[model samples]
Target: MALHPALTPVADLVGTWRGPGRGEYPTITSFTYTEEVTFTDVGKPFLTYLQRTWSPAGDPMHTETGFFRVAGGEAVEFVLAQPTGQTELAEGSLVTEPRGFATELHSRVVNAASAKIVDATIRRLRLDGDELTTEFAMAAVGLPMTHHLGSVLTRTA
Candidate 1:
């Protein structure tokens, strides 16, 4: 199927990417991992998103599934669910750059009773050619919003 008009702004993201990433939080020890992210378009207005991370020894660390939507013009939305029992609804703007695009999304998080206290999160993604860089900040576990994860990934497909 041909790409939807609304997805043109983000068409470059419809592939798999992998690289190393770093994670740090006030409540946990800092660490590094291998991360893989994939974006898929099923001929729909939104792109299906999936991400996974693993330790150097190949132990799975984190995973999330989501949908990325370009809601007409520069408006964008992301809906995500994590195995950690957290759901996120994020909204932000997508700005087209000379090389690619940059997006900053702020999310309201809902956590299950058994989950840790995660109140909000902010994610910024930038795409330039085959390089994708992302940074994430979170307000959780009695800590203020601070940088939590950053990664630079190369297109693998």
Candidate 2:
């Protein structure tokens, strides 16, 4: 099936990417570890996603996987699950302009440890060339959460 030209910008993201990243939360005494995210497009309207975080010592920390779909022209809905006995459903919108590809995604993670759920908003921007930058923020435990993660992935055959 041919993808609508309007969806090309989104379809161009159909591939696999890997990189290292860090995370921070007030609950932790210090920055614990890094992470890697894998995005796969199975020739569908949505992208299949998986993310894994590892301790600085190289031990596995946690993992999450889900599907991300676009709706109503700039809105996106994500359905995902975590190995820590939790699942998330988020809604947000995408904004693409002359500057770059920007996406604001809000997620509600259920069955968390400290709080009932986490409300996180993620933003990603495609920069000049193959570079991509992303920022993540959340509201949990009645406070605000923020972080960063991104990578420059070359198409692999």
Best by lDDT: 1
Identify the leading candidate in terms of TM-score. Answer: 1
lDDT of each residue in 1-157, candidate 1, tens digit only = 9988999999999999999999998778999999999999999899999999999999999999999999976988999999999999999999998778999999999999999999999999999999999999999998999999999999999
For all predicted structures, in order, the TM-scores are 0.98, 0.72
> What lDDT score goes with residue 64 in model 1?
99
What would the per-residue lDDT of candidate 2 be over residues 73-146, giving only the tens digit for each residue?
68777788876556778777777666446676667777757434555545453532343444556565556765
Worst 10 residues of 2 by lDDT: 148-157
lDDT of 1 at 138: 97
In model 1, the runs with Cα more than 4 Å from the true position are: none
What's the lDDT for all of these models? 0.95, 0.61
Residue pairs clashing, model 1 = none
Clashes of each: 0, 0
- Candidate 1 C-alpha error for residue 115, in Å: 0.5
